[model samples]
Target: MNLTPNRKEHREMSTIVSRVRAAYARIEAVARPEIWIDLRPQAEVESEARAIADRVTAGEQLPLAGRLFAAKGNIDVHGLPTTAGCPSYAYEPEADAPVVARLRAAGAIVLGSTNLDQFATGLVGTRSPYGAVRNAHDPARISGGSSAGSAVAVALGIVDFALGTDTAGSGRVPAAFNGIVGLKPTRGLVPTAGVVPACASIDCVTVFARTLPEAEQALSFMASPSARDLPPLPQRAPGPWRIAVPPRDQLGELDEGWAEAYEAAVEQLRSAGAEIRTLDLTPFTEAAAMLYQGAFVAERYTAVGSFVDKAIADGAADLDATVTGIITRARDLPAHQLYTDQDHLTALRTQALSELADADALLLPTTPGHPTLAEVAADPLGANARLGRFTNSTNLFDLAAVAVPSGKVNGLPFGVMLIGPTFTDDRLARIARDLEPSVQLAVVGAHLTGQPLNPQLLSLGARLDRTTTTAPVYRLHALATTPPKPGLVHVGEGGAEIETEVWRLPAEGLGRLLAALPRPMTLGSVQLADGTSIPGFLCEPAALENAEDITTYGGWRPYLGS
Candidate 1:
């Protein structure tokens, strides 16, 4: 819980124990017991932290070293009972689920089980017997479920990240409500061998993190290598991205504040260099409806109908009433109806894929709006369905999605989800980065607008911010490389303001751009004429061995002309 770190820290062994102690203190201060179904003892978690430190000190490379995480009640964490949000059905798991085990192998410590909607049946956090999970932003509002506790824990900074399961937006809805990043990797990408099934065939193990990078980092370790022979992702050329959004008519009843926030998020996407297009939500809507309205709910019954039936027969009130009703009713869905629904879904998937074939990703409000605890209590079924407006069809259509908080509405968080075809997880990440804050980059040579390598910046979605110059404290050298390049070197005594084009790109893109850059060129702080420093291109002194000093020309373009 070293909140000061810009990124989730890779804790040094020396501070790992203290960090765990601090995390426990934060947990107590927050005082929201409903967030956890079974929190591990302080001494137990501390022991694991110390063990990780010891291993790290012994020359082990653990990417998630000393990171703390929680498993949704449905996902097995060794020694903790797998509840799937129904205490009556709790059973001791012999070992951690593969997803949890992978994280633990990489040095992430599991704190214990988090609360969720009983049997993972509802989108509202209220369906759990443990008590409603309050929104981290506002206690009066719902924290979203069936991953309620998982999302709230991450939002409250109680854990670095948590594992959640998504069948019908269970992972994403809560993320939007709690203002965190929910990453639903392609189905089968993260093994669900040990997770209690909500809808076994379509269930996806998801990650909830405070930021996109953190979520992406956690997913890297969780996802198995691609084994399916799926179609290759479309190769996008250098230019603005094509993003599809639902037309006004397709957007279900949205609160005014939420509608405005979503419109603003679309505008932000446009400003980030995306071409907005209208996508018909008919096919997606149809597919989503089949999950509950049609025979697909039978899949849920197939997963845990027996247990639910037994609980009801025993007159156990531990089962959520609404959840019980849904499962019991689905039990009677005729076998032929399931196939009929599947055939219908196949056609709808084809239609939806065709509609999205030309787009990079489909962007939608993560949910219609944030519902309060009272709203859900008032009409359990109606309120919960509204929250899945944009999230339900993803698994059915075999898509990957990432839900990210865009902004606030009525002092509550509003979020958007970027959905793409399976195996497009990486592409989705790049596109989602557009929604993040950008950094100013100063470019002096080939990367300048309209120059030989300018397309590189365009491909990475970098936009020209403005034309500017460095504070008269740099020397420009023309490096002798293929196509040639200019190197700007800061010289304290004798230098001139070098002509530079200030471009902006997301921090993630900047990292990628820097990594692919040719040798001898480095990205470092460049002092601007206004006495501000920003990341810009520089070079090693070795590159200047036989290069031309174009300092007199003041810039790359002018020197070339001369």
Candidate 2:
């Protein structure tokens, strides 16, 4: 993100205040007020970070030292109001929520409070008094919330990580749409004290970040002991991963043919050596239905019914209609119906757990697909329901999940969630790390990791996959762009094996990289000596007419010695 020009160094030794300032600079650069509900004054934020940095001088080590984060409005930030996206319900919190406090103790700076679905009730990020959070990648699309602002903040690089509460799929859905990592810990793994609840018993505070390591870094600091916690499982237990894939007929429809994209995610993991087993998703899907259609919805009312009642008395117009409807329905559930539903949930939870008995984790599309703001507005409740099709059951069944960016389809971000049994958070996190998708691009000149345009790749969250040489069929040429660049041209015969570093970039990043490329250079498939062909840089043959042939350098890195 270029937030810290000295990132590699500062992340290791910089003072928290300095890093915090850099983070604020990135926020200022974007200037997105709509993405934030309340920002701590820069001076106040720096002061807090500075105090934390002093501990390093005193010889204390902090795992998340110098990291910056945004908290969903529902999560109390000491000096900010906890609105849970309802202004009328806002209340100044005397202290940070225990989870937020823990993060601060680890040296993470809170940039501000972010927007969410009113009372954290909807999946579409639009049901809030604050402006709808525009999709980080596409302004016209829904951000996929309840945890909307938290997801968008991380996606935009405004924060290194963010706190989001997930009840249903609020946390994971937005991560999928925004193309980032979303870790929805098993319920109670992170303390919820001082945080507003959605469905109190099942709600989980989640962490959203650009990478799995970053999310895990934050997760470590927020952990709390709970009576229901299961003993930790082996992190990504080795060997062929027994991943349970839902049968194709059970996936239903996905937007823009994303059903195929979801399958592609399964195959990608398979390529990495995971064993896939398809199974019936009916029980899981039915349990998901009980959430809003059955009596369990009463949990939401029990958590916030009083607040809604007060709001209605003050003026119902101030409350979101959809939220009002959901809460009101919960308040009216007959005691007998509620008991019967609870029994049903118990049966379904048992069934859901049985399905995971032989698998490392359950894989599902994070959301059907991204919806335009218009599409959501036209069918507010229905649209939100569809977004939760695959997600609603996780909390109901007491599972852990981490959503990893899978790929893009029809110009939208698509992702899959790795859901494992409760307390399998570590295992799910590790599997997510293994499954994060990236495109292996062989870079020649300016795009090489340390070169001038490398920031473009880093900005897209690219990482160096490996360095290698091309097959003995390509020659290198120095393009005459102002900054000077290299073009790798494949000639059928009499060519050198060009040295190149293949970078693993977010698949959706190709488009952004292409938009910034200078003429005569374009992305095309290039084969390496290993006989692997992946998307890489290429030059228009005509441009080579006037270009300097630098094949002797073998690659761009050595040519730069000039």
Candidate 3:
């Protein structure tokens, strides 16, 4: 998790490489060989590492210098086999996929090719012959796929980041389950040439990382206009922003834990000064239904149709029944129906575009809910379709998304996805990074400067806020609780200024801090003198019902010292 280097605290490139090498050694100690269909030899990886190190040492501003990452097996890595999770369908590529080549050019070392659900067909991680990928947080749970191994590799700290494909929820689902960040870029934003297509028109190369910053770093390196056959993307200006959230009716069978977590996440954003609004998701939901329920399934067949036909003719079909059935069904559709589906898709796109016009981004759950490996196996197709309820329309509508870890539900990770119109990738990443819980929580209580609790914040990647002040209307009360608790009360109209210090913590750290808080004290929105609000500590009304009002002393520290 401590993969990023401090921008101000410079270190030699060799040092970074050595740190990564040491981490990889640990991965090797518990190595699951089957999780990889093909791996770059140790010598080759080291050689690439050394070359990257040399470039960084020479003062080249390689944005991803000394970082190691992996690609899904379907993506062409020069000198490595492109198997698409099917050995019989394997072929040696003479060149790296355009996206991979770009990452390499930016100084990232390609560690190896990871496994996936066969041909990227299922959302569950068990369909691959290479092996079933286990959850990073809990081995018993499914890792979520077809980006299963890619998500696992990052969550387990095996690599700084990794690449996967997202036609459905292949990219975001895995990230959500594994507690990491998954970025499914706009179609054609990251070139897909040399990548085996699941549905070529919709397939997008995705990135996974432990944090949004790392994912954005990888994305910035990989996104570029292709020299050949790249489609056009929109250009928009940035300013006052509006974000759309799903109407309550569409939240979709969420568990209590997840519902609470999502609500808390939204409150956090509101506390950070973001204007949250509701949007009718009917258009998006309708378009998502068409991905598999309509003729778009035929696009997958069109991508691999000839290969499938030839393989079947040779008495060897290299496809899973579910995938074959989904693809073959497309053949039965008449040309007229296909055209009709396209026209319907066009209408949906128009409706979506109009709905999104007033907002800069759409916020929704990355997946409707999480399903265990056993649940997925019991009904593969149904469970997989459910996972894509929020994601299928993204690529089809030509939108980009960043799936960020919101928080945990009963110890299981959940995420919220931020979707935007094409070419807003940079803007979306910026907002997502800011919205992350850790970054927005302004610690001002026992965890302030030079206190015992300060180190806790530091350990969670918090930075000191130089300009700090307390709520002008608050009166501090010495609470009758453990850990020397304090209570803040709002004093209307006439109030005294209080002393407080603000410290910035990351999203992951904020969750830890909240979990550690004792009863009666909780995190809530605190308004400052200048009319700005941020996440801070507050006491339940019951806790302060009998407490004495001590507004005369100004703040807790002053009153406590007296």
Candidate 4:
């Protein structure tokens, strides 16, 4: 019944597939037929499994090797009807969305397309004609959407991850409801070549995974730019990072339990050595308001107006009344008004970006609070808007974000989002990886506390060693490398008390750090103070030819400082 699978369990390939099939069977047994308008047949699923098995047997290097995932119906999958949860608007897509194609190429098997708020319109899952996707933690509560089914699938362990779109918190709100990781990469970072547009300029292809590492892996494989995609944004290096959190007063009527959960999460980050500070999010809030209140709604109308008008004319669309009203209003907005709103949005984006000048990431609740399905249904538009209070601003400001499960409140899941400036997807992922407790690694080098690279370590979510040390007989060398590197060398005997520190890094950051490391230094097993060996940095003996033997100084910082 456990949805989250740990790779460390070393479950056999057949067993993993069996678990997935069993989960699907259980889903069928529950008979929530309305959750999805179309479910892939067992024969099709089995065929996909066989294909995956053949690939694995051929020894292919599949990034998502043997993993199962799903995509929101709005995103195309060849041969499948992409209804976007409105049966009347359904059509067969000739090709997969670029994002889905990348995932499949990386060894991920698609189970089937999931339901969504029709045309990816509503933040609440209830707008779908297919059925309201219930919150995973509490069926009575609403599953924040339009990525509703994608989040529920991962939360229920139906897949390793799911692809969703975020125009206004669509990617993140469902993650909060399901207690999963929702990553909204920078706009245009993941191509939208085949995705049905919600807001073409601001739409982001997003991922929902059970863990931060899983989400990051999916992001790495899917973040490539293509001819149809936008150009890559420049990368930013880490530094002494400043993280901003929303002021307590700005949370806006969060129930007592959610308020307590947010505070506890902030404390946890503080304990992890993050410089948590409060900043006014008013500018960001104002930008979010523009998404709906300003002429931005006209953009959504522009994307789907022709099709919607045809459907309405034919009386074939089962559009939600609220959506119909909103779209109709968009039809009446003046061109000049749209231009004015665009200028206003540009100004707000400028102001929001300026606020992040001193901060590497901004942290906030994924949503103000969780609302029940009944609550949302009774006053659908109002409840849906409230759920988007914290999320609507993200796309408007063109920010990258990762929503991490911060733990539960009153049996309902709560999440915290790490927001960074555009194209800093990798940086935000690194920080989120550190915040997650599941990924564990050992570090030895300038990354250790009091060392030259310690700031980088802290920015990536590293914890300093307090009661750790290196093996007694190892020699430490100070490598002649920029940013002042250190080398830990193992020796036979009579070695000095070479001071060192140990740290645990998340797998994503570890990969990035390893990739960026200069020649001569690499990650390998190092004997710890207690005779145990964990993955740490060591240098090739050849590098020592020009390196300084600073074993006497005990580690890199003191040696480099002198």
Which has the greatest TM-score?
A: 1
TM-scores, all models, native as reference: 0.80, 0.78, 0.76, 0.76
Off by over 4 Å in 3: 1-17, 225-240, 313-318, 439-464, 468-562
Q: Poorest 10 consecutive residues of model 4 by lDDT?
A: 1-10
Provide the RMSD of all predictions against the true structure, rounded to 1 decimal. 8.4, 7.2, 10.1, 10.3
**Whose lDDT is greatest here?**
1
Q: Which stretches of candidate 4 lie over 4 Å from their true place?
A: 1-20, 225-239, 437-562
The whole-model lDDT of each prediction reads 0.88, 0.84, 0.78, 0.77
Two-way lDDT contest, 1 vs 2, winner: 1
lDDT of 3 by residue, 79-188 (tens): 89998887788999999998999998888888888989888877777777677787877777788889888888888778878999999878888988888999998788
Q: How many clashes (backbone atoms < 3 Å, residues ≥3 apart in a chain or on different chains) does model 2 have? A: 0
Model 1 spans > 4 angstroms off: 1-11, 234-239, 438-527, 531-562
Clashes of each: 0, 0, 3, 0
Flag regions of model 2 displaced more than 4 Å.
Answer: 1-18, 225-239, 439-562
Question: What lDDT is obtained when candidate 1 is compared to the true structure?
Answer: 0.88
Q: Candidates sorted by lDDT, descending order?
A: 1, 2, 3, 4
Determine which window of 10 residues in candidate 3 has minimal summed lDDT. 1-10
Which is superior by TM-score, 1 or 4? 1
